[model samples]
Target: MYIKLLYSAIALVACTSARPQQLSLSLLPPAQQVFVQPAQQNNAIEPSINAINKPTNPIVVAAFQREALLPPHMQNSFYKNPKIAETLAQNSWFGPGEQHAVNRETEKIPREKIFIILKNAGLLPTP
Candidate 1:
């Protein structure tokens, strides 16, 4: 009985292992194949460093349009009144007392004093 059970287990394992391995090669559809060709070669054609430096994407330009990442006061005004978007853009630094207002709101040390903190936190560019 023991020998029979051992032979059956071995046979089961052997039978399972003997099956042909599945080769999962997913062929892209004709449209996808054509679309992917250009994208695949996109990085291969290197542009001049100057060309690479320029922001070609409109989305990126639009994102940074406000400048200084919108500061906190501008964000409040923007949510309260959409018209403030235009107003904020005209100002050099988003809003009146924005620097001081933000400084007062946060408990964190002032940016000037937090140079080491910013560097250690990976927020500021390292020298």
Candidate 2:
């Protein structure tokens, strides 16, 4: 009972004495200014939206065409394939274990590279 009373008293004191953490922006070091030069304009004309959308890689273009031709029901099965799952896992920047599998930057990598990856894995045939 005495120990309990002591603990309760200690807890009360601790609670009463505790103060919220205070932060001031003035206390922080000044942020360094980084100046970026404006990008130079090129004389070359920009590609049209059609050209941008179109797959330049033959293998990717053929795969896309084949997928487009498939019925809606078949299209569902194509995406759900285990081989595609494995390929996605392999292509992902992060993996299950300690291995840093950021082999390719996800955003920057083209769809053609993914198609090529699938083709090399024997999931897709060469076009």
Candidate 3:
């Protein structure tokens, strides 16, 4: 099939070479020819930034609480499951960052990046 396609392309090029054609090109209009510019800038070009509504700790606390409510056997798997662990750690700024105070570790890896890596590795759920 590829050989036939290649042959067809070669035939097209060969056929086109047998004829001569002229093509017309046009130059762009000068700045003066363009529409008049507006004097005033748009009032609201960007959307306002707002803080996230839910605090991060409650979700983590909820997950732990939910796990505690589960049977002892299920609790082990709930906590240990990589997907659950990674989801609970979502950092899309996904959830809030670092709950506890920390001064050490100069280059802290964002949880979103960690979640991305785990998601790529099939350890976390992929959207």
Candidate 4:
């Protein structure tokens, strides 16, 4: 009972006698004058409504054209078996129309992994 009363008294004193510390407002050197940005100013910004001309895109071609391979002997040797060539072409990467597959593979790479790649590639400074 005495301990309880002592604790209660101490708590009451702590609560009642406690005063907020006064903050010392020491005057310092005046801050530099601010330059307000023009962009932040409330002004009527008219949107650009100019007619956009359709850009002429270059025609995309096959990965390997008939005449692309140089040296006739090498070309002939490579093209000896048409069936084998066709099968290999079907399974080969960097072939024509493989952009969709590349894009799918690209999506599989996590964004976090790109940071590590950039660090390894010396593109981004290590944090």
Better of 1 and 2 by TM-score: 2
TM-scores, all candidates, are 0.16, 0.20, 0.20, 0.20
Q: Record all residue pairs in model 4 with backbone atoms less than 3 Å apart, i.e. clashing.
A: none
Q: Write the per-residue lDDT of candidate 3 for residues 61-127, one digit (tens) a residue.
A: 3334445555556546654676775565454333346344222231233333333333344433443
- lDDT (Cα, tens digit) per residue for candidate 2, span 1-127: 5655554454334333322111111222113223232232332112222222432333233344445455656665644576885576457434456542223233343333333344344444444
Candidate 1 overall Cα lDDT vs. reference? 0.33
* Model 2, global lDDT: 0.38
TM-score: model 2 vs. ground truth: 0.20
lDDT of 4 by residue, 2-30 (tens): 65555445433433322211111221111
List candidate 1 stretches off by more than 4 Å: 1-103
Winning model by lDDT: 2
Please list all clashing residue pairs in model 1, or write none if there are none.
none
Instruction: Provide the overall lDDT of each model, using Cα atoms, as 2-decimal numbers.
Output: 0.33, 0.38, 0.36, 0.33
What candidate 2 gets wrong by more than 4 Å, as runs, is: 1-56, 77-127
Would you give me the overall lDDT of model 3?
0.36
